[model samples]
Target: MGKCKGLLERLKNNESIVVAEGYIFEFERQGRLKAGSFVPEIVVDHPELVRKQHEEYVNAGSDVVLAFTYYGHREKLRVIGRENELETLNRKALQMARDVADRTSTLMAGNICNTTVYMRDDPEAIKKTENIFKEQIQWAVEEGADFIVAETYSDLGEAMLALQCIKKYGKGLPSVVALVPHSKDHTLDGVSFPDACKQLEDAGADVVGLNCGRGPATITPLMKEIKKVCKVPLCCLPVPYRCTPEQPTMQTLKDPKTGKQAFPVDLPAHTCGRTEIREWAEEMKALGIQYIGLCCGNASHYLREVAEAYGRSPPASRFSTDMSQHFIFGNRKDNKPYYSETLRKEITTANYK
Candidate 1:
């Protein structure tokens, strides 16, 4: 309900910050709903779903529960004829996160993203984009957001504008600016990653790094490059979908080696497992990345792995073990079989070289 003092203190003290991804569209798709432009509609209509997601991330060890307002801005809502509910949707999004955060004492972050109008010479577009960001940031501050995140920009200029808006109306709350590079080294607009990091840092971003567009394998090298020029805190939250030059979005993604679709249309089939995610977290920690999180296609299970990898026990561990003692074949409870006593005893006594 108040400012997120604990998170601010951690950032100021140079401690690692575990951020949970604020992805709502994918969950909507799980319920067989349209996902493109109506995601905010679902947030307004299904507050409980969003709250349950926030709670899952909190239990998975997120220090911050970001509001599900990634694309709830005016333009986005206008596409679905819901522009009138922009303020109400954004406020409700933050409220859902706040409600869950109160239970765990986790911090809350108000989220905004690129406006997709990055033409610097277009005065009309620039003014419109500024107004868009201004309105969103105002709502975020009005709703008592602890911090703000302007992420997933493909153009450095757009990211700069968002950062400027945040600096102007963020009410001194810390802000993170995360870009989505077309490749590992440069934004889609051709700005080098280092240049983007420097520009954002100069524009008053508290933390700067990359998000979306690529997975951990591609982002690792890019982060190493960012570390060279970025002195401020770094953040990384890559999408789980595997991508190729020809196919970037989850629906179009393909495996580079196999030359085939990497996953079903609705599921993140290429998501890294707990072990791989842990390795990514460990590497980022070594690289002095103070802010680490997941992006699109991330789930509570992935967040739990990140928390456990960072030495925090997942809340589920309180009722379960890392290893399972029983195996089920199907949903039928009565027909299930258990491991034989002799086999269980032998496994318990098995020796390794």
Candidate 2:
């Protein structure tokens, strides 16, 4: 067993310690300063940017800093004409994470997800997927990853395959299998949450739970259901978007006039704030969740709030001598109705013919 396994065992024995896993794909996507998938390309061109994100998470109190390899698989890289850079991408991502984690004595986790190509009928495709997972896991272990996190998997079969790969190639490193469910009860492939978690546990997952499909509000009940069946330490890293079962993805937003899809980051209407995340962390801690963390759209400020809620010292960026001075934009000195002259004139003007 590896260090993460030992840490998880200590946590499971009621050690009163909480592990925070902070994801960086969304943060990196935003930092890429353009509109496209920021996978292997970012790892090749912006290694420092990736390192900076890892540093921020570590400073924000993340116990584990995951490598920015969420979509660095071969198939995903092929879409951007960089499939040949798979080894470099995965190794560099792990190195970047290890570098940042070393500075703060934080754990580093290697990440793998679904390949987006589930051809159960095609044996050749299955072999390809298996090889991809095997290679990724090997690199993770070789690159000094403290653990392996197989996340955002919508299919039970694929999730199990990832776990199997880790067990076979990860050399006894701790592994977490987090499923992306279609609803509160079942995974996207119609497998019940309990059944999915149970299968992963049986397949040697050190921890199992949900991530990336919904927010804390929706995932709370799902976590309860998982608790009823899964005996291992649970992991819940919900996406920060305000989505529901009816609308799983954030791509549902279409422009009213142009009918073009808008990005979730561009709209704050569905984003989770610090207060909500802190409340969610409190609830999870009460529910005996040992591995608590954030998923997509997770920022340093959000993780700082979670850390503070758990009675841990928040990052320096979130600390201040005066509580009222915590707001980046200073609070108003007085309560008064104020509006721009153009908006006020528009409100008072009569309709034109």
Candidate 3:
């Protein structure tokens, strides 16, 4: 099948697309992969699983089926003693994503993430980082990726490098570069959110915004600042977990009872519900953010909420919640027989004021 509409054309036509990410965390939760290394070996190990995830995200209204290569870079694989599988993983993941995107008519994004080897002052670390992005991008180009998503960089310098690498190696593909600032609301290099976005835009990023580290509550504030400065279309894909002012990023979030950081694992209970995702999407659309999605902890249901809020009715929306068909809270006449009057009375003691 031919490629779908490119990101720039979609944005020009006033389209707001949802891009789903977070494969590592979700796969880890399903026991298909490990956490610390977070290499996307699942692409080479469980191709069907990765394919299903891409299909589900498309069904859930993700307009872009980003290749599950977020951490499939050389450095990340080297950590797991699988650096030899780097090329295999990147190519396989991109191909899997392409198949799903072609079937669904969704855009396929080549994903290059932070190499974790980049250092602010180390020239060798920067070169390694550039090399990692360059090789992955070359494979994406060969695999027919519609665009490139360079994401999860905490260092603005590294993000700039990724953008440069994409321009150099991506063969003119659009680049959606996203940053992940911690609780400080600035990059490790001390660049504020808005300033970082402005710099990316000036450097010719097709899209720039925040993703991953913060949730809706914490990320939105940073996005607001970015929106004020960036002329390019903005992208915002926050984590699905709840983040507050004090606990501004998932890494800082503590289990209320245990008082320990709840990130990476032990965060299922703190995930944002459908309502919160819907509200977050609504607010982002209102702010004119063009690309919206979820990062770590993302699921199909959450993407459904974001898509619905953006006025889309994807295939998965067929199963959206219909409380009227419920047993207790349902007001449908057909549901009356399912519950006794006494049961209803016992279940619902309060009514709307």
**What TM-score does each of the candidates earn?**
0.85, 0.83, 0.96
**TM-score top scorer:** 3
Q: Give candidate 2's root-mean-square deviation (CA, Å).
A: 5.4
* Model 1 pairs whose backbones collide: none
Give the Cα error of residue 232 in candidate 1, in Å: 0.9
**Clash pairs detected, candidate 3:** none
Q: Which portions of model 2 miss their true places by more than 4 Å?
A: 1-6, 15-40, 244-267, 317-322, 325-353
Local accuracy of candidate 2 as per-residue lDDT tens digits, 215-317: 7777778889899998888888886666555555445534445556545445355777778888988888889887887776777777777676666784644
Comparing 1 and 2 on TM-score, the stronger one:
1
lDDT by residue for model 1 (1-353), tens? 44455655787797778888836545755662355553467678877877877887787778888988887887788877888998899889988877777767778788989775657778998898899889888888887777899999988888998999998988887889999866436777788998889888887798999987677767777899899998888999877655545554454566656667554443455666667777888888888888898887787777776776666776854643333434432334454466555565676785887
Q: How accurate is candidate 2 locally (lDDT)?
A: 0.75
Poorly placed runs, candidate 1 (over 4 Å): 1-4, 242-252, 255-267, 319-321, 324-353
Cα RMSD, each candidate: 5.6, 5.4, 2.4
Clashes of 2: 0
lDDT of each: 0.77, 0.75, 0.90
Off by over 4 Å in 3: 1-3, 348-353
Which of the numbered candidates is closest to the native, going by highest lDDT? 3
Error of 2 at 108 (Å): 1.0
Give every collision pair in model 2.
none
Q: Positional deviation of 217 in candidate 3, in angstroms?
A: 0.5
